[model samples]
Target: MSLDALTFRPATLADTDAVVALVESAYRGDSGRRGWTTESDLLDGRRTGADEIHAVLAKPQNMILLAELDDGSGPRLLACAHIAIEDGAGYFGMFSVDPGLQNGGIGKRVLAQAERVVREQWQTPTMRMTVINVREELIQYYVRRGYLRTGRFKPFPYGDARFGLPKRDDLSFEVLEKSL
Candidate 1:
């Protein structure tokens, strides 16, 4: 829970599988149900794929920021979030924290670091993200972090199983923004 013990760094291609696993574990399947952030009830299947991560890593301005802790062994990935410049603002997405570590302060620290990375490294003044509209609790978490709901909606990729297999017909994403 102490930020001092967490190491923040940009992930490399070598981290693709780890990143994918962390993401999937946090949001999909039975493993994800261990965390409050799990979308497993609303969707099934993978949250993200290796190919998608590879595409993101292939870009110069984009990065997957990793939060790691040594925990007596070598550092292990605890959380990750994807950041990129989109339409001149920081686009934050693919955020995931270990299911066992949720509700601790680790996610907040990682998010603050992500905002710093975007504001300082990318010189972006704002950060944006899309959250499923039905996830009111999750949206409130971001709201507490200073993000505002824009009332804009993006259709969930219903046909795209790569994103997830929708459990219902009402799934959609709402935009959230915070000025950095």
Candidate 2:
């Protein structure tokens, strides 16, 4: 779909199911394989669940930003990302775009809106996100969008079913930050 037909809005509890499905399609299992953003090779099982989405919605200063497209057939969820202000910086996570729409500039648009919201609404000077350290290509994609690698790392939540099952022992997260 064209970018002009897209709409950005804060996700509500009613959108939990669609958001979960969109995230799963972009990151886990066979369905995610259709997209370049799939993490299927590095992880297994579900990427996210309805309960987690519900928790995000119920929290203060947190929101799941959604991108919807109306192509005359009716509005359909296309992409989403979770954003929250914490420790004086905006945190971005749970990002996903429709597999069929990957590399078509939809993700970039969603990211721009997320950054705008953090900057304008939260009045934050910086935005931060963590990417799996092994995802060099994904990191490079963010680099092109002005995010810088901080060389800081965090251990992956091994044994945490909520995050996903790690396929390798070396899995870890590298923090990336950008000045807004």
Question: By TM-score, who's the top model here?
Answer: 2
- The residue pairs that clash in candidate 1, if any, are none
Report the poorest 10 consecutive residues by lDDT, candidate 1.
1-10
For model 2, the stretches where C-alpha displacement exceeds 4 angstroms are none
Q: What is the TM-score of each candidate against the true structure?
A: 0.97, 0.98
Kindly list the per-residue Cα lDDT of model 2 for residues 1-180, writing each as its tens digit: 579889999999999999999999999987789988899999997889999999999998899999999988888999999999988899999999999889898999999999999999988989999999999999999999999999899999999988888889999999999999
Residue 22, candidate 2: alpha-carbon lDDT: 95
* Deviation (Å) of 119 in candidate 1: 0.5
Backbone clashes for every candidate come to: 0, 0
